[model samples]
Target chain A: MAVDGRDEMRPEDARIAALYRHATGEMPPERLDSAIRKHARAPKDAVKPQKHTLWRPAWRLPFVAAALAVVCASVVTLLVERDGGRLTVPPETPPPDGGETPPFSVQREPPPFSQSMTDRATVEPRSGRAEDAPTLTRKRAEPPREAEVRKSIPESKARIGERSAAPPDGRVLGAEPSHSSDAPASRGNKTSGGNAPLAYSQPPAPATSTSPDRVTAPPAPRAEDDSLSKALPAPSAEASPAAKPAPAANPRPAPQPESAPAPEAKPAPEAKALARKRLESTPSEPRVPARVSALIAELENEPPARWVERMLALRREDRRQDAEALLAEFKRRFPGERLPASLQQNDE
Target chain B: MLAYGEGDVAAFDELYRRHKGPLYRFLLRQCRDGAIAEELFQDIWTNVIRARRNYAVAARFTTYLYHLAHNRLIDHYRRRAPAALVSYDDEEASTSIEEIAGSAHERPEAAYEARQKAARLLELLQALPTAQREAFVLQHEAGMSIEDIAVVTGVTRETAKSRLRYAMAKLREGMQGWL
Candidate 1:
């Protein structure tokens, strides 16, 4: 311990060391020692804390939680059913596949994404030139693009304006030159005159399963449609004789797909106004998309700054066209206001 | 320590009883504050109790205990004075003339009577830079040999020896009359 001779305190250093020890030598307070004594004694018996082994098994708890959540959800759901619908879970909006399946058919097949989505293979026209129908069927497979839908809108509006705008007696596009008989069948649907929202027109089933067999009380006309319709008067039923039959036969138990072609079942702007009219006229909700009334109404009177914010939000919702429409509307609404450079870049 | 680890409560009490005085003095001198010293004193023992299960028979018990005390002292200084930890291992700090004069003015001129030499020695001890004072206290109060001091303080033996030498020289100068 003294190899470096630091241990050899000179007799003077020795005296100084002794002096320091003499003056300052004092033990810690008795209470502190007792506290330490208590701490020391406890750990001997506290060996039970080796619950470290519990963690090895604890890792499985995530799966346990998932299983418990699943079991609890299912048990609770069953109990709700058993209790005659008292303790029911929050209602999830059912996917509006083309036709409504009975409630018991949940998982009766892999969700109707199976029926309407992939196997829309069956919609090749039942009556038109067979070859032309496949192209429309293939086009419907992908959801309609914004540009194409926008492109279809001008044509639809022009056709509606051209055909319907003139007649003093309120006779709009009734007899198409191709389906002259088609006009009356469409006008007959009571709801045809109701300007339904674009969302009301659901997807198409294949021609066969565009199941007229399951037409639920023909969709009710939305209030917005009522407001919108007042802008354009209902075509006098006396004017088109075809507009007469659909409303008269509510459960027109004719299961074979009616006068509206299956291609109208695709939500293309292909036969926009007529199809919307026909969808309203049809007993089942046909995939007839109406005017963009909802967006204009929603974006109405919001703060000008918030317009771009809503546009950005629409873009985030993956409705890029809605975002663009809102942007154009914003530019029209606040013609002089400069949008954020980034939003303008995204718009470009 | 092995006996203590084996749950011999008597062994720990006997160990604490033997070392508590020097360790308390070591902490008191390292920190000039009494409450901080007491707090550090309790902390070192608490650590000792906590580490008892893993207490090995490698180093001398005083060395181990003082090693804990030394670390506790450095931690206390580190928390209080951010630069203290790095400055701690250096050679003795240079005391400024103003600081020396200020502390000197604080000394009781009348109390420098012969019997009060020990009190003056303590005041002088506190006036020394922390590293030199710690080395001197480790040598004197703990009675640690230079090698054991080096091990406890985590310095080389020569460094420890030089610090002790410096400390002894200063105390000798301050206590020249007593000598």
Candidate 2:
């Protein structure tokens, strides 16, 4: 017969039979019972993670903190760099003193001579005769008072000079030679009671040589007259015919002999030496020979004052010729080296 | 005493007292080696202790206990060396008491035959394919229904029923004349 009957028997029949037989039988060997006990005891010392809690992965907390830190740092750095770039734009509106635009307005004006001639013409229409001029006539009549006034002028004039130097229009005061017209009135006032004629006269010589003749000559003549009023009358027996104009007013000229000597004691001599030193210490362009550099270095410490005076004299005679001579001398010394782009051109 | 959910040693000992023998016999029948059965028995009880926090009172205690035992036996089969599966050939010559029934009542002959039959039954058990045997033991010997067998084997009731039916048919056919 087919075994369907056995197959269809209840699921528990086999287990119940096995259990009944097992219950009635002798107990299993003691060794078997003890083995089960030993198995349970073995795992007591094992240190597994607690069953309900997930294992604490050792690297996880530090890893998360480090990742967050890196991301935050990157974001902060990006924001700072971005803000810096936007903040760096050149200021659109200039400061209170203004900027570079005013100088171009200056360069567009008429020639320097024309500007000085205009200033002199404006002041001259109000001027009295040469002998009756307010500053000069008063100085000739009252010498001691003139000297006191002249001394006081420097302090007040220094303040005015500072203001003129900082023009409201933002144009630099000395940008053009035409402004030299403004200097004569101030210098003439200084020379009116002049104890040191050379100090007052030396400035005019440089001014005359540097500025255009039309702009500087008229102002210089005024300064010379101011210097004459300080002279004492000399005794007639010893006076030369050449000194007559000054000796008539200066009945004793010996006390003022020091005025003529002041011009000979020049301070620009030191300034020239310092300028040369600056040039020597500033390294020449790389192509110049070492021998030429050493010569230049020596020249820097002790500039030849005679050469600068000769050069200025030559410039008065002919500016282009003086400039050519200086360039030729420089070329002869360093024929293979090119001049710096700035130095190749004159300061003018 | 610590509660059942606390994983306390005492709670676990009580759990062991309630189910250890049945689970041990179940593994012995499933593995057929005293050593392997003993090893599997300990492993099953250890898994019970380990999973103590996960246990609840929703089902019979035996169902939960035998489910753990069945799972461990399946795991042992998977872990066994390839040569161990092949060693079933050595067990082919052994047979069950159900195999020699006519003279089984003859005193010493019956005693000897009974012992041989028990040995043969174990061999037949080992000879069955792992899935069929697992289904058969969990259902018939563990006293689990098809649904309980499915839960233990992680299979559907249909699959457990099919496996049990096949196991029973094979055993019935093989022991036809002897039984």
Model 2 per-residue lDDT tens digits across residues A191-290? 1212212123334444334223212111111222222222212211222332333212212111111111122211133433343233333222123334
Tens digits of per-residue lDDT for model 1, A204-265: 43211321211211111233333323432321222254234433322111111111112332
What is the DockQ of the complex in model 2? 0.07
True contacts kept of 2: 0.05
Looking at model 1 chain A, which ten-residue stretch has the lowest summed lDDT?
A104-113
- Listed per prediction, chain B TM-scores read 0.86, 0.70
List the DockQ of the predictions in order.
Answer: 0.40, 0.07
Query: Per-residue lDDT for B49-127 in model 2, tens only?
Result: 5565566776677777777776776678778897665222222334443443323333253556445555444445555
Chain B of candidate 2 achieves a TM-score of: 0.70
lDDT of 1 by residue, B1-179 (tens): 88998889899989988888888888888887778888998899989988888888778999999999988887787788565443564443565334544554566666545436567678778867777788888877777888898898888888887887766666666666565
Candidate 1 residue A17 Cα shift, in angstroms, is 2.8
